[model samples]
Target: MEWWGVLEGLLLVLVLAALPLVLFALRRRWLARSGSLVECSLRISTRSSRSGTPGAGWALGVARYSGDELQWFRVFSLAFRPRLRVTRRGTTVLQTRPPEAAEVPMLYRDQRIVVLADSEGRQIDLAMETSSITGLLSWLEAAPPETRYPV
Candidate 1:
């Protein structure tokens, strides 16, 4: 084969590999422009699932408040629907702590971990910027007057 043919083949492979990444970035940007998107990390309790291990671990995602539910979507996924949704009613902020020494590499400097418990006694963890905690708390607090959820 000629040198030009080899070069052309290599170029085609590189462009094909990069096409998905470019589309992923474009999709993320579109999500940001469509709503009040936030950079968040989510961890649910130990449960068997297809996406990851049976044990719970932090997965990077974006969250947006919609009515009474906080919709979370995986950053790496191209899915149109949320991966998880937690309602404001009975959503309690159990505790919040700074990221651990081991977690520092995975999280932003201003981010902290917030633990929440739903009314059904299931636990959900969220990591978000320090500035966004108050906003999240307020969203939980601003539920319908009859709900009366506390942070």
Candidate 2:
């Protein structure tokens, strides 16, 4: 009976520790499901920073949206009147799409884009210029089907 109690306690602790991880994984899965398919590459032209600038000078981002629900959320968030551009590479976005300026508790001109992975360390970076709609569409139209699907 004592052993049973000990096992039960251990199980409880294990479950408690795992709950957050499970929730996190589920959230990521939900986001991925909501993300749009990356069909092709876009030519990204960003504001030209001074020559020899180390960081991403100019770039735009394409928010990936897979469904209407998320799409509405995107529009709703933007209503707050904050102009959010994509963060540069190595940056992290809390959510895939930009939020409303009014909705955001605090506003930072530069945004962070989150990266999900399975590794010891995690990464969050400012969103960088991804590609342009015209360029992406062109690439998508040209690329073979095998290359377009996400892995």
Candidate 3:
């Protein structure tokens, strides 16, 4: 009888330890099913005024288009809100290039990276698959005609 109690206690501890991971998986699934999600690697540009070097490193996240804005949420996070949001009207693709060999291990295989500048002049790097690049370009170009003016 005492052994049974010990077994129950051990099981409870295991469940408690695994609860966060289970919740995170559920959140990720819900996000994916709720909208268009693109798997991407993101890094804040190193050219910011605060620092000459990049901050920390890349983060793996899912980018979802919510109306006219793109929301980025980290994959491993438990938070329900996006960490970054970029409006379509203010986003510009500054450049696109294949990942370097060192970066290849950090990103999805065969995915290309794009450098984008927002209206605030902040640079953001996004790495995604080739097909996703096409989708992203189409989304960026699909801004309402009234929102676009001659550069």
Candidate 4:
């Protein structure tokens, strides 16, 4: 094969590899601008066998408030629907804290992580800015009175 052919082959390989990444980024940007996505970390806590210590794994995702629900979509996923949804009716904010030294590196810049529990006792960790947290709290608090005590 000629030198130009080899270069062309390499170029094609690079483009094929990078195409998915470019598409993913474009999709995320579109979601952010159009859907008002808030960058966040979703914690996946695990239990260790030996010591039984809880370990946390954070996945970067974007969240948006849709009507009375908060929808979370993974940053790298191609799905159109959110992977997790939290409704305003029976959700409670358990705590809020700055990212730990270990978690800071995993979280986005200037994001605060908040722990929330649903009525079913399931815990979800959401990371966002202080302003976003305030907005979330407001949204949760603004749920209709009837929804708070469903018939």
Candidate 5:
């Protein structure tokens, strides 16, 4: 093949390889942005609630899943253990119809934030209340060693 033609082919191959890398980076950026928005929504929900006890409130989260059956994940503190719950009816009627499998009691007061999502990873809704960021830190510090994850 002519020198110019060979160079042209090499250029084309390089462009094809770079194209995929560019597309992958764009997808990652998009997913990251969406995750950030979800996190922001959770933070805002708690920001407006009545942070009772002179800012003694803390932000804890509970996530409920929808579809054929009810499922949930509760995280009281980022540094502590996570509780998972699964039910047939749903979490909303926990009092009327208790969960089929009980893990840990999720306190309404501690749950400053609640989120609902589908299996596809789409967030359905979220709720948040002003949390004493300081209190959460203290609770996390005192949390059991087994509950914490080492960096």
Candidate 6:
């Protein structure tokens, strides 16, 4: 093959490798500008864990609050849709505390961990900024007078 052919092949490979990254960036930007989003780390448990510590694997994501629901989208993903949708009705905060020594290194600086459980009994652990947590709690508590959501 000629040198020009090899160069062209390399360029094609490079573009193919970068296309996904470019798409991910574009999706992230769109989600950011969409509004009412907070950058948060989430740890979702399919089943209950015996030990009472946040899962070591926390997925970094942005959460957008829709009417009575919070949608979580993974940061490194190209999917524009939310990976997890949490309803505000009957959601309760289980625990709130500072990150443990091991968790501190994995989490962003000055972030607090809040464990919450939905009506379905699924536990969601989220690490977020103080203001974001306050906003979330406010939203949870903002339900109609007849609806009761324990914060």
* Candidate topping lDDT: 6
Q: For residue 40, what is the lDDT in candidate 4? A: 73
Give residue 108's error in model 1 in angstroms.
2.4
Per-model tally of clashing residue pairs: 0, 23, 0, 0, 4, 0
**Model 3, which residues run further than 4 Å from truth?**
49-56, 149-151
Q: Pick out the ten consecutive residues of candidate 5 with the lowest summed lDDT.
A: 91-100
Task: Give the residue spans of candidate 2 off by over 4 A.
Answer: 37-63, 66-126, 129-151
Supply the global lDDT for candidate 6.
0.84
Pairs that collide in candidate 5 are 45-128, 46-128, 46-129, 46-130
Work out candidate 3's RMSD over C-alphas: 2.5
Q: What are the per-residue Cα lDDT tens digits for candidate 2 across 1-151?
A: 8899999999999999998777656644554575542221112223342234323332332344322111111211213221232212222222333423432333234443322211222332223223423332343334354343222
Choose 4 or 5, whichever is better by lDDT. Answer: 4
Alpha carbon deviation, residue 14, candidate 6 (Å):
1.9
lDDT value for candidate 2? 0.34
- Judge candidate 3 at residue 100 and give its lDDT: 72
Q: Which of the predicted structures, 3 or 5, would earn the higher lDDT when compared with the native? A: 3
Which residue pairs in candidate 6 have backbone atoms (N, alpha carbon, C) closer than 3 angstroms, thus clashing? none
lDDT of 1 by residue, 1-151 (tens): 5999999999999999999899889888877777889888988873233234323377889998888899999998987789999998888888998877766666655788998988766688799997688889888888888886653
Ranking by TM-score: 6, 3, 1, 4, 2, 5
Whole-model Cα lDDT of every candidate shown, in order: 0.82, 0.34, 0.83, 0.79, 0.34, 0.84
Model 1 local distance difference test score:
0.82
Rank order (by lDDT, best first): 6, 3, 1, 4, 2, 5
- Which digits, one per residue and each the tens of the lDDT, describe model 3 over residues 107-148? 777789988888877888899999999988888888888665
Question: Can you give the TM-score per candidate against the true fold?
Answer: 0.80, 0.32, 0.88, 0.78, 0.26, 0.88
